[model samples]
Target: MQNLTTKLLAAAALVAVAGCAKKAPEQLPPPPPTETTPAPETSQPTGPVGSTVVPGSKEDFLQQVGSDRVLFATDQYDLSGEARATLDSQAAWLAKYPNVRITIEGHADERGTREYNLALGDRRANSAKNYLATKIDAGRISTVSYGKERPEVAGSDEGAWAQNRRAVTVVITGM
Candidate 1:
């Protein structure tokens, strides 16, 4: 009698446990489709031969020239052959737009003390600025050094460092 009572209780508990099991949730309705508006079309304006459509504009300068900056070798302030070529093109662009003013920003890789790197970057910027002065009015260009504060790429590797060491010619006004 005792064994039968225990068995009955066990069966009742099993049924109770089974009843508490979870059931699948009902499915929700799908979301409605979203409507999007078409973007306005923008075209690049054409300019006369040897002139930019938007003279002194950063976009025009970058488009007409290969790049707005010249990369430097590690820890070096001297301009390389390629750097010279790029600066030469930048000078010609500056010459074409006589009213344009530029700021030469010098940057250094993250391998030196803040003070040292700042000085190095200053030298780099001045190097580029001095070179550009030969082609355009010296008064049209200014120089600033960011040291390692603003890096083009973020990494400790040589590839990233190489990119960080650069002098960028930025159009400040007259665009």
Candidate 2:
């Protein structure tokens, strides 16, 4: 009888405690999509000249320039030869569309302190911006550093890290 009463009291207490817990809303929103397209292994321009690329559009930039991003070495913000080539293509494309404005987003791998990564990302962004500024008007290009907060690939492995460490030029205006 005593054990039964103790069990009942415990059960009642548990029920009371559970009742106080905030109930989740019945209609929770769906989670946001996370799928992302991987960048191509090569940066060579693949779009046919005078192709059906919409002028001053993001799609046009990607199709015309082959890549809007340039990968960087770990802990290094300097543009690689391949990166420069890609940037050169980008510059040529930009020259064709003088009304376009771009924002270079700098990203870092998920391997450093937030503050350090932010600074590194900033340097990477500036590197791309400076390179582009030489050909395009300095006022037409802007930069932003996402640091490690935005990873191109979600993993702790080297391959993922390599992809995440990059500066991506985004066509923000003149679309």
Candidate 2 Cα lDDT to native: 0.85
Query: Across residues 81-120, which tens digit of lDDT does each residue of candidate 2 receive?
Result: 9999999999988887676778999999999899999999
lDDT of 1 by residue, 1-175 (tens): 9999999999999999999998886987887643222112234353566664454467667877878999889889999999999999998777767766789999999999999999989999999999999889999899999999999999999999999999999976432
Worst 10 residues of 2 by lDDT: 35-44
At residue 143, give the lDDT of candidate 1.
Answer: 96
Top candidate when judged by lDDT against the true structure: 2
Separately for all candidates shown, the number of backbone clashes (residues 3 or more apart, or on different chains) is: 0, 0
> Scored by CA lDDT, what does every candidate get?
0.84, 0.85
Candidate 1 lDDT score at position 49: 68
The TM-score measured for candidate 2 stands at: 0.69
